[model samples]
Target chain A: MLKNLLLNRNLTCLFFILIISSFEKIHAQNAQVINFNSLQKIYSNKSDTTYFIHFFASWCLPCLNELPDFVSFSDQHKNEKVKMIFVSLDMKKDSIKTLPQLIEKFKINVPVFLLDETNADKWINMVDKKWSGSIPATLILNNEKKYKKFFSESMSLQTLNKLVK
Target chain B: MIKNIFDFSLLVAICVLSLGFSIKGNKSSYDFHLKNVGGNFVSLKDYPSAKGFIIVFTCNHCPFAKLYPERLNGLNSKYKNLGVPLIAICSSDTITYAEDSFLKMIEKAKNENFNFPYLCDGEQLAAKNFGAQKTPHAFILWKEKNNWTIKYSGAIDDNGAEPDKVQHHYVSDAVDELLKSKKVSIPETKSIGCQIHFRK
Candidate 1:
């Protein structure tokens, strides 16, 4: 009886370790880096997934304030066909320190990218002529249908849901 | 009694009208005194050699402002020599974003190789004075016989993205017109940039 009990405990420990290892692997896969060029391809591939691109800066208060809402929205609809991407508008220098913390803190499961280009005006205009170079901006794209909308303010979960639909 | 009531009502009406006028007159101009990146008090009157002044509502973190740092530096280099000193005031609230702090402003200026004065608007008084709504808002003033008159108020340029695509260089054009003793051709334009983050 003593031998059987010890064997049971060992098996339980082995099970827990396996579960933990699987979790770590999943997290590592989730944290994979998605660069901008790949994102462009994703948007152009006519995939069924809806892309939600958020333009944010480390120093933008409004962007930080609205981040939690986006996280919750992403979580609630994780099973859906929606994919989220955070694009950091922080200067290339600050991105090295700030972007990773933001992704980790928010537990952002989707891809996150940093805008590496200089001369914001040129790139901003190229991204969307109506952008007006504002932070806390969002671009919702239905890549399958090639439909897009630009939101210049904070978003609510209800609004995000509606956009996804 | 009826005559007296009429006189009282007329007096109240005149008082209201005069108050409106006073408010309108007060909207003409106001003073802003704020600390610079070095923690020294900087005011409009500090530039004794300036005929007038240029106040630009800018911040260290806005990508829009970052894009035009060199342009603004060049503006300061040229305009200061021509008697118009430039002052960049950061009106973004620093309470939430520590990066916009006065110390960070100094670091940003040094990193960007700034040549002009960058002032910290602790309470956004300068932004309120000019009704600046966004980062990179420009207000140019000209002294007309010792009275500082606002010559131009608007965006720095029509094209903020590519320097080459700009159809109109509003600030430079206004300054040139001021130097030529002529009124600004375009007195105002819509400002496009990051919204000024005001503290709640």
Candidate 2:
């Protein structure tokens, strides 16, 4: 009977440890706030790697809807030298908490960076001249190796596949 | 004498380059015959009685746009009789964002009780012509002798998240200056908004 009680206690402790670990996994992925210069540095650092950069804001409903699509696309292209990074336009102070929550909710492990610049016009044209300072914009670059493309809208799975290649 | 001429030529080139950079490219407003939610066709030239019009590129689903339904209503009610009525256009591509389709726009207008004509830019021609980057973008046009000329372009206010937190009333201020026969002090201001999804 003593042995049975000890086994039951051990099982309860194991269950609690599992629950704590899962919680930490869900909540621990924090987003870093990056300025325009830093953002440029990141892309410029790896010229040979294909980069699929997505810009989104927390309040944008269309952005929220397409995020899962972006995650899935990144998953399929993980081994293809394509690096997908989500740059959020959400305020750094608020997004630190919300972004990870969203990542967990979507069940997608992805790199998210909060764009810290408030002067949107400064970087909007830098991203693409055709971009009129809009959210849910995606910019794809193969650096100096290939061509770069910018799309200023929410894209579907088919459109995403077509544009990435 | 040669050095003086060279300096003058360089100065002219500098001035030209500065001028080119300062003024953003301007495309004359496109002619649109869009249907309002009431199934009424709204043409820019239809408001002959008004001295000017407030053309707002807005949609139903954008969160920032949603914050200003009451404010827009207030603007229409307060300013329509003042000769600057509001004309809102939804230019999102209907195929991707079905909530912004013509029928959905009608239901939303009914629900919001939008007093102004909420027109649907089915082909997004109006948005393209106006260079509207996002939803809730406003362009103020004043009747200039024979034709309407765009005078002010940008956000309605500084805060789209909360009305009470507004610091700048860009549309109201511009309209006020126009009413007083004065140039708008701040002609343009950038706004935070959802990008208008255009079809490829």
Candidate 3:
């Protein structure tokens, strides 16, 4: 009986380890690193669904303050045709650690992506000519409706709801 | 009733002040009398022998601005004798970012051993006048007919993360061209950094 109990305890430990590792894997897999081309593809998709792309950085205080609202908005509209995506503009050197840490800390369940590109001058105009390369900026795009709007400031949940539809 | 009148007068004063400095290049000259980190008020007019100025909008809290201190120091040393002294201003809203408070700015300047004068735009008047959008935003103003003309505006260099890999020295190159009486080849550029939000 003693031998059986010891084996069972070891097996339980192994099972817990597996669960934790897979949990981490899922967390990491949720956020992907994408280039500007991939971002263009995402915005260019001509579908009935509206895509809300929020551009932010870990170091930007205002962006952090508004993240939870965006996440909650995404949660409330999970079944709707509105798709929320977060794209981080954090520096490449620190994004690997900081991006995931921010994701986990914020309990953000929506799909996240790290924008992997340099020379913002080249692509910033492409994203939005009005965007002054500021954080907490959001882009709402729906190719089917031919509707696009960009805001370079932190927004409220009420504002998000009003604008998404 | 008296408070409302006072508010209206204040708004009028702000409008008049903002109109003094135009964002467009060669439109108007801008002047600022801001407090320096050295516990004294300094202005562009203080430098009587200056040919122009390199005014940078920066703050202590922004990580991107932190990376450019050494580069700014280098630029100041390289161009100070050339009659274009570099002046850095911290115009970040202290209410939002305590790290960017005037006291913290003094501490940062001291800790960094900054050779150039770090000024405080307490009201963010200078930032609004220059239409500065982000931290580490650079502007090169040249002395033309006794007025400061904005010849170049934008990032300090091409690379913010890796200074060694910098391909274009936008600010300095503009300064060099201005000194030689030539037009700036690349007058404007954009950078990725923390935005400077206006105080409510």
Candidate 4:
């Protein structure tokens, strides 16, 4: 009986270890590192799904303040056709740690990506001619509706909802 | 393929046109007499011997701006004797961010041992006049025919986080070229930084 109990405890520990490792793998897979070309594809996606891509960095204070709103908005609109995507503009060197921590801290369930690009001068214009490479910028696009817009400042939950509708 | 090429050219034309418009738009006013941290107003006119100015829109609260105090000190120490002096301005709304208050700016300047004048744009007139979009945004103004003409604008350098690893010293290179009576090679470049809190 004592031997059986010990074996059972060991098996339970192994099962938990497997579960935790798998969770880590899933978390790692969710946060993709993308480039400027991939970003253009997302905005220019010819689909019915409305894409709301928010650009932010970990060091930007205002971006940090408004991140929870985006998270909550995504949570409330999970059943809708609108898809919320979070993109981190954090430096590529720290991206591996920054993005995953951001996902965990915010409990973000939607797709998350890191924009792995240097030279903001080149890509800022491609993203939006009006964007001055400031953090907390957002892009909303829907090919079916033929609607596309960009905001270069912090946004509120109410504003996000209104813009999507 | 021909149609795609035509469309690409059209897009490029529009981009160039818009870029021209923006470059011209920010040159409305180049003179400012804003209060410095030493409780006195300072302006380009004060530095009559100055051939140009390195005006950086910066503040106490921004993390990005915080990275550049030492860099700014270095730039000033290098260029001040060469007829170009560095001047930093805090044009962020004091109401929104109390950390950017003039008192705090003075404290920050003193603590950082600023080698140049740190001005407070209390009413944001200088920022609006200069069309400053974000903190740590740099502009190199060259005196042309007795008028301050904007010669270079944008990031101080390519890498803000790691100064030692910087490949492109945009501001310094432009200043050097201007000093040598040559046109700036790369006049403008974009930088990632905190947006200046403009009051609505």
Highest TM-score model number: 3
DockQ of predicted candidate 4: 0.41
TM-score of each: 0.63, 0.65, 0.86, 0.78
Relative to the unseen true structure, what is the C-alpha lDDT of residue B106 in candidate 4, on a scale of 0 to 100? 92
Predicted candidate 1: interface RMSD? 5.4
Docking class of 1: incorrect
- Please report how far candidate 3 places residue B44 from its true position, in Å: 0.5
Q: List residue ranges in candidate 3 displaced over 4 A.
A: A1-25, B1-27
Candidate 1: stretches off by over 4 Å: A1-49, A126-130, A143-148, B21-52, B59-78, B97-125, B128-195
Worst 10 residues of 1 chain B by lDDT: B190-199
Error of 1 at B187 (Å): 10
lDDT tens readout by residue for model 1, B1-200? 99999999999999999999997886665556788777688876677678777778898767677778888998999899899888888988888557778899999989988888888888876787787777888889887776677878768987665778777888988998888888889887654467877666
Across residues A33-128, which tens digit of lDDT does each residue of candidate 2 receive?
789889887776546788888888776778888888888898988888778888888755567667777777776666778887755545777888
The global Cα lDDT (0 to 1) of model 1 is: 0.77
Candidate 2 local lDDT, residue A99: 79
Candidate 3 lDDT, B1-200, residue by residue in tens: 99999999999999877776444532354789999999999989999999989999999999889889999999999999999999999999888889998889999999999999999998988998899989989999888888877888888998888888888889999999989999899998887888887887
Model 1 lDDT tens row, A1-165:
999999999999999999998865554444334545565676666788788888877767688888988989888888988888777766555565667677778778766677654445345654566665667888888876878898978787788878876
Q: Please provide, for model 2 over B69-185, each residue's C-alpha lDDT reduced to its tens digit, 9 standing for 90 to 100.
A: 888888888889999999999999788778898888989999999999999898888898888878889999898876788899888887665568676788999999999999999
TM-score of 3: 0.86
DockQ each candidate and list the results.
Answer: 0.15, 0.22, 0.55, 0.41
Model 4 lDDT tens row, B6-119: 999999999999999987874665888899999999988899999999999999878678889999999999999999999999999888788999999999999999999999
Every candidate's fraction of true contacts kept comes to 0.23, 0.38, 0.65, 0.72
Q: Which order, best to worst by DockQ? A: 3, 4, 2, 1
